[model samples]
Target chain A: MNKSLNIDAQTVSVEANKTVEANNTVQAEKRLPGDLAMWFFILAELTVFAVLFIGFAVSEQLNVEMFVQGKAKLHQISGLINTLTLITSSFFVALALTQMHQGNGKQAAKLLVVAKLVACIYISVKIWEYLSLFEQGIDIETNTFFTLYFMITFFHLMHILLGMVILFFVAIKAAKNEYNASNISGFESGASYWHMVDLLWIILFPLIYVI
Target chain B: MQSTNANKKNTLSWLWLLILTVISTYIGSFLELFNTQKSLFIIIVLFIVFLKGQQIIDIFMELKKAPKLWRRLLFAYVILLPVIIGLIYLL
Candidate 1:
């Protein structure tokens, strides 16, 4: 009888352990998905944009007329179009990450290509806008507004180019199935950088063209 | 099946982001360009920006499940900067 009770207790303990393990898996703790270094880089990039944005705003306050006048010269439709393109491209990047997570690297590669194409529209529109401004005698020395406008938008455009290069590199690797369900840190890190670029533009749009 | 559901949710969030962008553009034009309702423009536009920024941070950046410190730091920047800019414009 003592032997029987010992076996029964051992069976109960084993069952309890299994249940605990199952629960632990089902309720896995949340974690950030990419490189910690990438997160720090994003933070640094955001801080730079924040400082520039604040400077632009404070300058706006000091010279409302110049800012308003400069903003008027800018094409609101171009701003709107660029905003739409960036956001759409960002959506595709997110979708690509999802595909990567599902072990569909080919699809993710295709999605990244699509995203880059969309971002190309933004590049085209912005360049045309700059050319038009130049035709109208607008330059960095045009006024405080144009000076900041040229400075800030030009800085942001460089970021978009850098992001495109990063995404391109990731997409090429993803096409070879380098990233999968178990290995996606590099892809996630690149995607995070792309998102950061989009985030900066979201704020820049209204700050420069609208209000 | 779970991945499909996640994709669906992301597409829905993308739709929301598009809607917010459209709304902000329309409002900005109506108020700032037309020079009508100027007083309310900054608040409304900045609020929309906050929503858009929050969505990108959560859904796109995938920072929603991150540690509280990182998520909160980004959130603070999105909110605080606009508040400061809006205050400067308003006052």
Candidate 2:
């Protein structure tokens, strides 16, 4: 009877400790249930991309020759390079999650910073590519293909910018040690969104430029 | 203990996703099979995407371990929302 009473006391202490720890965690991390929100947002954003894609498909049907011609005019190498950058960034963010899981918040923050840098490189090169095409006499009004090209790629760049912003915030939180494995949802969601951004580029690179 | 479990889950899911990303990118590039057969390529790519995406949503987002209603709501968002949007686009 005494031993059972002792065991009950131990269990009570453990439960109390758990509750205290949970409370401390909530205070320290303040991570809103960010994953569901991010996923739903991604789903909505993908829909927008799909609509634009459908627009492109319909337009392509109307003007296949123009698409072929525009594909010829744009620099495929730049598109490929941009795709590589985004892919590398996606991998970096994935590694960031691993770093956080390992309790290396500073390292995870650094990875996110590096990811953001890669995103900046992607955006810069994309803008330069667009401007160069314009200086070379390409315009959105030039043809149906150019219209879809600028529209879709511009929307994509905006998403990249938005993603970089989210990464920046998550990086700051990680550096503050508020994004360890217990509350890594923000980091994970940011990485997922970045992956989606990268995935879109992967599809767009070949579709818009190659075939 | 909970944190450790979360860590293991994150690492496993991240690895799965990286492999998926690499494979899909290669598939998109190499398969000019889509050139001659547009709808077929779309179907295959979309299927692969849905698989990868559902995994990410389920694992990384913790939907698989969530309550039944939470999972149902997420499934509704994933499945129904896209269909609604696509129909709007079609119109």
Candidate 3:
């Protein structure tokens, strides 16, 4: 009888350990940095950009001379400035997240405002570039190169605007101390989207302007 | 203390990214000025683009701390897109 009791006790102990281990696994599974939904959106955005890039490549291959000429007309200085501005803005946003995580909400908000201001510079420069192109009679209907150029860039610009809107709301919440280290999913989601915008530009700049 | 270390690392990454941007711009200008071996220049510039994308994914996006699968997928996106484009250009 004592042997049977000992066997039952061992079984119960093993079951309890198994439950504890399962609970630990559940806790560990929550370690992803941002909202799972945001990752899905990011994946979709990246896929679209990839397709557009491939399309651009195919078009360029078919019309290499025209593509070269169109690329030559682009303002390298303006492209470089915009690249720098976007990258700096990305840095600011990343820093803002760091500040928020450190419990410095106001500082985070200020950094985001700075990032927005830099984004404004990028937008203004882009507008000047578009006006220059328009003055030179280069529009979406100009050629396949310009068509792809304007379409891709303008689509990306819309994403930038959307990212700004997201950052604006994130900044407000951050200023109100809404995010903590453990509750930064919203902030991270916004940052992730903004970084996506930056990533697209990083690819677009060299592809369109330089190469 | 850990947060401060992270902040420092982020700052350094930002500075490195900026430097890479400047270097790529200089390379573009060099190619424009010399007009030599256009394919080679394209490859170099696109390589820079790939590096910048990776840095952003790893550092700015905080995928360094993310799951291994997420990191691999993102890295693949950054690397593969440029590689395919480079191949298309070369062909």
Per-prediction backbone clash count:
0, 0, 0
Instruction: Compute the lDDT for candidate 2.
Output: 0.69
DockQ of each: 0.74, 0.17, 0.60
Residue A176 error for model 3, in Å? 0.8
- Per-residue lDDT value at A90 in model 3: 93
Please write out the lDDT profile of model 1 over residues A150-189, one tens digit for every residue.
9999999999999999999999999999887768999999
Each candidate's interface RMSD: 1.0, 6.1, 1.8
Using TM-score, give the best candidate's number: 1
Best-first order by DockQ = 1, 3, 2
* Model 3 regions lying over 4 Å from their true place: A1-30, B32-36
Clashing pairs in 1: none
Q: After best superposition, candidate 1 residue A64: deviation in angstroms?
A: 0.8
With a 3 Å backbone cut-off (N, CA, C), the pairs that clash in candidate 2 are none
Model 3 per-residue lDDT tens digits across residues B1-91: 8678878988888888889988888888777566768788888988999889888998899988777888889899889999999999888
Tens digits of lDDT, candidate 2, A10-57: 999999999999988765544333477886887687668766766776
Docking class of 3: medium
TM-score: model 1, chain A: 0.89
What lDDT is obtained when candidate 1 is compared to the true structure? 0.90
TM-score of chain A of 2: 0.82
Instruction: Please tell me which model should have the higher DockQ, number 2 or number 3.
Output: 3
